[model samples]
Target: MPIRAVVFDFGGVLFDWNPDHLYRQLIPDAEERRRFLSEVCSPAWNLQQDAGRPIAEANAVLVAEHPQHAALIRAFYERWPETLAGLLPEGVALMERLEAAGMPLYGLTNWSAETFPYAWEHYPLLHRFRHIVVSGREKLIKPDPAIYRLLFQRMAQDLPALQPAELVFIDDSQKNADAASALGWHGIHHLDAQTTAARLHALGVDC
Candidate 1:
């Protein structure tokens, strides 16, 4: 069956989200900034927050471990909005095109429940989605088949239920895309708006 909807990942795919954007000001040295992010405020550490851990608790645990970097750890969430530069214009244009073409759009994101509100306030485009499944709210992150299944289950509650095979899941992470594809959903490993638009066009998305 043809795809009925397009699912998007928020952070990298739709917006520019990089800790370095915020850390560059705090840590002067380029190499040191990279080291601080990789060793101290690691992706693994942040993933805990994405999985539903309170940002305050996560910050406290890290601060206690590295008292020297206490301020930096707190700044991660305290100045979190700085990390998001803005929504990618190209991505927004593609979404607009898709919307104009009357394609259904949904979102699935591994974001902190605590900070997602900030994004909701800043980015009005999020409200355009038919629905969004947030990992922090659900306590389930992508690359986990259960989370993918949960999205389908939620959609099933609607009239004329959406099928997995009738959706194309797009993400910056190859693993997440592969996971969706494994579940019979079309997967788009999104790199940029241009490529993503082309891929959608090829998929008969008309956007």
Candidate 2:
């Protein structure tokens, strides 16, 4: 089926979010920051919060495991806002083009529920979407098939009779895109806004 709606993944696709943005200043030394991020307040550890674990609980667990890095681990969430460098202009422009063209837009993101409020309040563009399914709120992170199914189900409520094939999903992670593809949606493994825009045009999307 021809694509009718677009689902965007937020982190790398829309927001320039990276721990390095915050950690570089805190750790100063590149290797030390790398080790702290990797061996301590790691991506895998942070993902638990994205999966709905409480931030405090997550911090406590990590602190217990790596007492030496307790302060840094706490700072991960304490100074979370510093992690978001800013919005990606090209990505925002693409979303604007799609919205202006009357294409329905939605969002699917694996973000911590505790922190998502900051993004929602600070980023006005996010308010443009018809709806957004946050993995943190749902406790289902990608590339989990269940989260993809939930997105489809939620979209169906608004766009009745929408089919899996009628939707296009854009995500920075190849595996997340592949998961959507497995569910019969057109998945764009978005590396950059230009590439993603080209793919969308090739798929006959309006923008």
Candidate 3:
């Protein structure tokens, strides 16, 4: 089937977001910072918020478990804005090309609902997507087939004839991409903009 639409994953794909951006400044020592990120405000712990857990609740849970690192735990969400460095230029350019070509674009992201507003406000280009399915809003995260199904459901509202195979999903995580592929969508494990563009071209997508 011809690719009819493109679905983008937000964090590592479109936006350059990393807790390390904030942690490096907070804990200057490389080893200390690594430990803090790994043991304290960890990726797994932060994923709960991405899964729709309330920010306050997440912070409280971490704080309770590591009282000594309470301040650091609170800082995770308190300074969440710092984590979003900016948009990836090449990905933005590719999106722009697709938009210009009139290909329907959509966003499927695993981001905290509370922090998403900041990106929505800061990056006007995010408005380019016809619709965005935020995992936090739905209390689901990617790599879970349910979330991908939700995306198809929403897309179907506007494009009733759309089939899973007609969509192409680009994500930084191979696991997430594999999940989309399981449902028959063309999943691009986006490692870089150049590689992603090449893959899209191979799939007969213009951009």
Relative to the true structure, candidate 2 has a C-alpha RMSD (angstroms) of 0.8
* TM-scores for all predictions: 0.96, 0.98, 0.98
> Model 3, 42-130: lDDT tens per residue?
88988999999999999888889999988888988899899989989998998998899889999999999999999999999889899
- Tens digits of per-residue lDDT for model 1, 66-169: 99999998999999999999988888888888889988888989999998999999889999988889999999998899888887877666527677788899
Residue 156, model 1: lDDT of 64
Quote the positional error of residue 60 for candidate 2 in Å.
0.6
lDDT of 3: 0.92
Candidate 1: where are CA atoms >4 Å away?
A: 159-161
Per-residue error for 136 in candidate 3, Å, reads 0.7
Q: How close is candidate 2 to the true structure, as a TM-score?
A: 0.98
Q: Where does candidate 2 have its weakest 10-residue lDDT segment?
A: 34-43
